[model samples]
Target: MSTPVRSSPLALTVLALLHYRPLHPYGVQRLIKEWGKEQVVNVGQRASLYRTIDRLSAAGLIAVRQTERGSQYPERTVYELTAAGRDTARAWVREMLAVPKREFPEFPAALSNLLLLPREEMVEVLGERAEALDRELAGLDASLRAEGERGLPRVTMLEAEYLRAVTAAEAAWVRSVVDDLRTGRLTWTEEALRAFGDAGT
Candidate 1:
């Protein structure tokens, strides 16, 4: 028996692209950027993309259709989705849509440790974060507006829309926290922290 192929964002994307047509690794990377999937999928490193492709091939989800050679470029192997791959892709989409997995992101982790910093430093840092998030939210709005103006279907850009919503929410939340911190509504002193920890004992 073969080990199950782990489903990662990149692996799932590889399967989905192969479902449309056979493509080489370079083609996959090109389409990802052109289609604006890079925001949600982490394929900034070519090596990681190649690794995911190799794993999918090994798992029997995808098969090589042919290899092409050109004078100016290195030989490229084109891959197509197998029957198993098509089924797996659909299953993954359903699972992803139906379930929300617990994920640990850096921002939350940092928020957990914010007490380690002095109040003034925390205010300064969080204020900076609010500014940065505002910038990010602006970029997402611009992208969404540009694509909408181009007459792209909303369905095709659902991920971007979701990201924009999430960014806007986080920006608003961060700004609120900064305001509270500045107003001394949300803050902790070292003695208070020590006493709180002792109370837990």
Candidate 2:
């Protein structure tokens, strides 16, 4: 089989937006921000957005519908999704939702090196993180409630739901670990540490 047209998250995002209608890059950027996709799509710089659009065009996923020009401002190129782009967008969404990619999240990386610090220090730091997760979960809950009041169905807000669920799960696990540490249910004695490996380099 021929190689698949690999799409970056930004490229797919642009394709998905263009699937709605032909729009200039500025419109794409605006809709991304307005739709709260900024959390997932990192279009921090306009150059990045332009670059993704260029890539999508080169990949035959998007095409320039027209360029609007006026003496009042610079010319703007309007883009729309091609048939291939529409199919790609639908396929990308399905793959992303169904496949749990191996993401290199910092929490797991930090957990792997957690023994570098004293158990007490680790507990203290994790307690702080737990607090932060609580605040984040509360904010998400409020946002979900507000969106529901505005008639946004849960299906449309599944991303937020996933985030909330993940955060809640992490918080619960952290609390359990904290309780175990405090009650001495989970710990390593000095002898056990030395037996397993050196406590110091």
Candidate 3:
């Protein structure tokens, strides 16, 4: 039986890249960056990428195509997707696109604990976040325009476009919430908070 590969964003990314052609770990990492996939997948740790590759190979999702050696470095193993891997890649793409899974990202988790911080400090920090989001939107806008000018297919930049849309929406919400907080429209007293907690009980 084929060993079951653990599903993760990185694993899916590796499988998708391998679907194209055989690639060594270094080649995979390089292509991820060159193709701007780092926006969706985190490949900051080379060790993590290597570990994922080992697991994929162990699971028979990918197989060793060949090993190439360069004079400057150690032997590099090229890997290609297996039949199961190709099918898994296709399934992963379909599921990820179709289903909106409940992912616990840091921002929402932090937001849940927002009341722990001082109200004024919350406003200040959130204001900073709004500014950062604005800057991000501007940069993404430029990238989108540049890609469009270069006649890059929209399919290729869908993630970037999604990111820009999300950033814009978040910025607007942050600004509105900050204004509410500053204007005393969304205020709470210690008594009110304690009562709210007691009500939850």
lDDT of each: 0.91, 0.85, 0.92
lDDT (tens digit, per residue) of candidate 3 on 1-201: 667876888999999988888999999999998787888899999999999999988889999999998899999999999998998888988988899899888999999999989999999999999999999999899988988888989999999999999999999999999999999999778998899899998
Q: List where candidate 3 sits over 4 angstroms from the true fold.
A: none
Query: What lDDT tens digits, residue by residue, belong to model 1 across residues 1-201?
Result: 334789989999999989999999999999999888998999999999999998899888999999999999999999999999999999999999999989999999999998888878888998898889888888888888888899999998999989988988888898888889889899667799899899999
Return whichever of 1 and 2 wins on lDDT: 1
**Winning candidate number (TM-score):** 1
**Backbone-clash count (model 2):** 0
Q: List the residue pairs that clash in candidate 1.
A: none
What is model 1's C-alpha RMSD? 1.3
Pick the winner on lDDT between candidates 2 and 3.
3
Superposition-based RMSD of candidate 3 using all C-alpha atoms, in angstroms = 1.4
Query: Candidates ranked by lDDT, best first?
Result: 3, 1, 2
Off by over 4 Å in 1: none
